[model samples]
Target: MAKSPLFERGMVTRRAVLGDKHVDGATARKTDFDDDFQTLITEGAWGSVWSRPGLPRRERSLLTLALLAALGHEEEFAMHVRATANTGATAEDIKEALLHVAIYAGVPAANAAFRIAKQELAKLQEAAE
Candidate 1:
């Protein structure tokens, strides 16, 4: 039997983009109320746009960070910003994005993103060194 397209593609893309440990941890945390939210995001966001080949993963990561920063979605922004370390987007890349956010999305938005990104980047740096 063929695997259902939704489950197979999303699981593959989700694992690829987020890493096994992250996805598995997310899965472990899902409750009945949030399970649908999890599935929707994994199958839609990860399985669809993130799986697209139009951009390199690093470029996509940069774009995701910028949009999240611009929108003031602090929690999601920080999560994606932290994912930058895994995607080879450095702290400098995040700084550049925040600079753009300051110009277009307002200074306070950029300032908050930078503060969060700094903590996240510091964690990555410590993990590396």
Candidate 2:
């Protein structure tokens, strides 16, 4: 199948935010069943939205984390937390975002997200060591 321009752009933006190793692993694991699903997100989420210049990646990262946490999407929230290192979002920034989640999205959601964030941040710290 011919890759659309949007898919190409999305691949670049996805790599920039998620890192090449992560993206490569996901690509290698792609199956015929999920190939289209993968393409949709690559084009829709990474290409059209993430590639836009309206908001910097740091801010986008924060928004994504908050939304994922509020919706109780634990896995995606953790992934985005890990992606923070590449997004230029500091631990402090994540704290503030989670605090908002606690107030607006409910304490339970925020609490769970906090735990995941802590674990993911620790992993990032250890990786840097």
Candidate 3:
């Protein structure tokens, strides 16, 4: 039923988890030049690891957000922050994770993540209301 054991769920799980716009934007950016890189991440990060069943989706989402935040990946952190809502992690959970990141990853990284999360979360909430 599933194609990729890595992304076995196909783009469905990833899209539902990460949002269509973000995933589509990423897909649209794929190029023959970057085909290898694209395949690597698609099969490795998105398909392989994220597809694993060990951790609950929310826990995986939380860990991903924290890692992205701490590593100073602003856009990625922002995207994952948005994904948290779908993963059963609340906005408050994101706040807590970022606060922890601030303490561990330094203020600048956390500050940027906060701003991004704030903007994205606000957008998501506005859509809901």
Best by lDDT: 2
Models ranked on lDDT: 2, 1, 3
- Which pairs clash in the backbone of model 3? 4-8, 6-47, 7-47
What local lDDT does model 3 show for residue 24? Answer: 90
Off by over 4 Å in 1: 1-3
Residue-level lDDT for 108 in candidate 3 = 90
Worst 10 residues of 2 by lDDT: 16-25
The lDDT, on a scale of 0 to 1, for candidate 2 is: 0.98
* Better model by lDDT: candidate 1 vs candidate 2: 2
How many clashing residue pairs appear in each of the predictions shown? 0, 0, 3
Best TM-score among the predictions, by candidate number:
2
> Of models 2 and 3, which has the larger TM-score?
2
Q: What is the lDDT of residue 121 in candidate 1?
A: 79
Give candidate 1's error at residue 129 in angstroms.
1.6
Question: Tens-digit lDDT track for model 3 on 33-83?
Answer: 996776677777767677778988888898898899899898788778778
TM-score of each: 0.89, 0.98, 0.85
lDDT of 2 by residue, 12-128 (tens): 999999999989999999999999999999999999999999999999999999999999999999999999999999999999999999999999999999999999999999999
Candidate numbers, best TM-score first, in rank order: 2, 1, 3
